[model samples]
Target: MTVRSEPVLVWDGAIRLVHWLMVLLVPLLWWTAEEGHMDWHRRLGLAMFGLVLFRLLWGLFGSWTARFAPMVRRIGALPSHLARLRQRDSTPSFGHSPLAVLSVFALLLALATQVTTGLFSVDVDGLESGPLAIMVSFETGRQFAEVHEFNFNLLAVLILLHVAAIAIYRFVLRQKLVKPMVTGRRPRADFAGADLPDNRARPAAMIATAIFSLACVWALGNFG
Candidate 1:
């Protein structure tokens, strides 16, 4: 039996911050939007939109493990990993499993689309239309507005499923899936064998994230 001794900081602090930030912001955004707390809800929506744009850029050019190419794997791998779970056997995990990677990408894409569309959406009472609502024709903006609302409901379902899956992994499978996300380190017992990616230096990830975040803000200010 081989024992893995060394622990690696697989997720950089920025990555962890963005991860939990979304977790906190999602529910707040949902409830406030539904309850007609438009002022705070709109503020939170804009914040989340900016954060998602930042994350998209980070996923493209940030740390080794953070890149979508490495994090999102082939779909077939998901079923195989789940089968291993059924047998009570250990599965190889470095960053995210294939299904989780897909879920993250899907959620990000959906959020980006929904947020951008909502910016131009108008309510039935003619009270509010997004700041950029005038950019597009009224008819097209209305369609996008409807899509935005539908996407929000879809995102909620996905989030609930994600939370349930994490719970199963924690209690049923006896794995600390959430712990690694919180601490950025996995306990030795969490896996049978762990083969992780080569961690890039922290300075590099931070530099890339900062540059990308600034560029998004600049563009939004100038053209938004």
Candidate 2:
């Protein structure tokens, strides 16, 4: 049973860092690509690459609230979740709600697609190209570039939906999703009967994930 009390931790710092950094990086990546700053674009792409990699690692090994298992149970429960949303009484999940889980997967898939395609993408003159562009034929690299651009559109749409969902949570549902994300805590009153998650991210997990992500990114850059 949930009790009203002071704010309690609901997110780990690394989880919050990955979320907000991606928020800032997505727009900057878009701008850099649009402005033809290929140098900075590649650098920023690597940074984004590292962040996404870290998150994937986090999903597998991080704190309880940041893991991937929660996305499974609630798939069939989505229509019910939406119905509750319409009634302004949507159930609050300790970590992610059903629809929020879907959004997370969609966004991550889109981003994964974006970064994967980008690694092999190539420009018209073969001048501005991904690190792995050299591994493929120019024609294939160009094709991947096209898919990369197309996937950006898909990613943009999902991002817009994410923002809209946040707005709904804040204004319509009267929930403070962003605050909990930033501060890593939520008012204990919000969860009526749910147990608090084991929100603390262990130092060992964080360090290992960071090192592994960097090594993976480094391997990709070097192997390409």
Candidate 3:
């Protein structure tokens, strides 16, 4: 007879919400930009910025599975992790694998760069400008506009790579990477006796963090 292990919570609701929201909003942002809907594009950019900020704060103050410390520590063992991967040793990580943490950080930084540049960007005709474009010289704003366009392409590449990685893990490695992000839970057998955290920040905390992020972005756009 085969014994089944109980399911364990691996991702928090807030983390899953933010992840899926980004999945939707990213394409919306791209489509809006392509359609010349600058108003919707700018609004989407602000929402993405706020979401990134909320994720950063959540990484620090939310759930253990979502935190940065374990992810960073795992980075030092990346060599061995790769070795195990080559050997097909399917050791389950309670959170992101070491290499995944690097990708996550890179995506965050890239998104931040995109949003910051967009804030100072202006179109060639000067008809459409970011809220904070007025703070910079026309020449500087134009330069930033160029950078903003470039950064979107970079973000697209990163996202494609991310999706490819997920596919590789799902098929080659026989790992289900998307399920936990959607359901916030994974079979206990996947962890292989790993000590996982049970504490997750309340929904109220996520709401508060999101509000704080939007306020910060609003203040920056208005005052600076």
Candidate 4:
């Protein structure tokens, strides 16, 4: 007779909300750009920026599972982790695997770069400009605009790679990655020998952080 283990919570609500919001808003950003809707594009960018800020803060002061310390500490063992994966060792991690942590860092860096460049970008006509365009020369703003365009393409590539990785993990490796993000829970058997901690944070703290992040973004969008 086989014994089934209970499900364990792996993700917090804030993490799920940010992850799904990014999923929706990123495509929306591309669509708005294609339609030449700069106003809406800017608004979407601000929203994304706020979300990113919230994530950065959450990674520091939120749940233990969401903190960057564990991820950073595990970086040294990434090669070993990859080796184990190659050997078909199915040692499951309760939080992000080392490889997934690298991808997360890469995505965050790419989006932050895109957002910063966009703030100083100028249009071809020089009529429409980013909020910070006035702080720089036309040539500088134009350069930022070029970089902004290139960074978006890079971001798209990263996003595609992310999706491909998820598919590979799900189909090829027979792992369930997406369900945990959506449901915040996974079968306890999957992490049987792993050190799983209760890493939930207060909902009120998450709300306060999100509101503060949005306020900062609003101030930046208006005054930067």
Number of the top-ranking candidate, with lDDT as the measure: 4
- Which regions of candidate 4 deviate over 4 angstroms? 1-3
lDDT of each: 0.75, 0.86, 0.86, 0.87
Query: Which regions of candidate 2 are displaced past 4 Å?
Result: 1-4
Work out the TM-score per prediction: 0.85, 0.93, 0.93, 0.94
| Per-residue lDDT of model 4, residues 28-51, tens digit only | 988998899999998898888898
* Candidate 4 global CA lDDT score: 0.87
- Model 3 RMSD in angstroms: 1.8
**Candidate 1, TM-score vs. the true structure?**
0.85
C-alpha lDDT (0 to 100) for residue 182 of candidate 2: 88
Query: What RMSD, rounded to one decimal, does every model reach?
Result: 2.9, 2.4, 1.8, 1.6
Compose the digit string of candidate 1's lDDT tens values, residues 106-171: 888888887888888877665766667768877877887799899988888888888897887777
The 10 consecutive residues of candidate 3 with the worst lDDT sum are 194-203
lDDT of 2 by residue, 1-224 (tens): 95558877788999999899999999999999999888888878888899988888788888887888765676778898888888899567888888888999899889888898999999999888888888899999999999999999999999999999899888887787888898998777778757675677688989989998889778876774
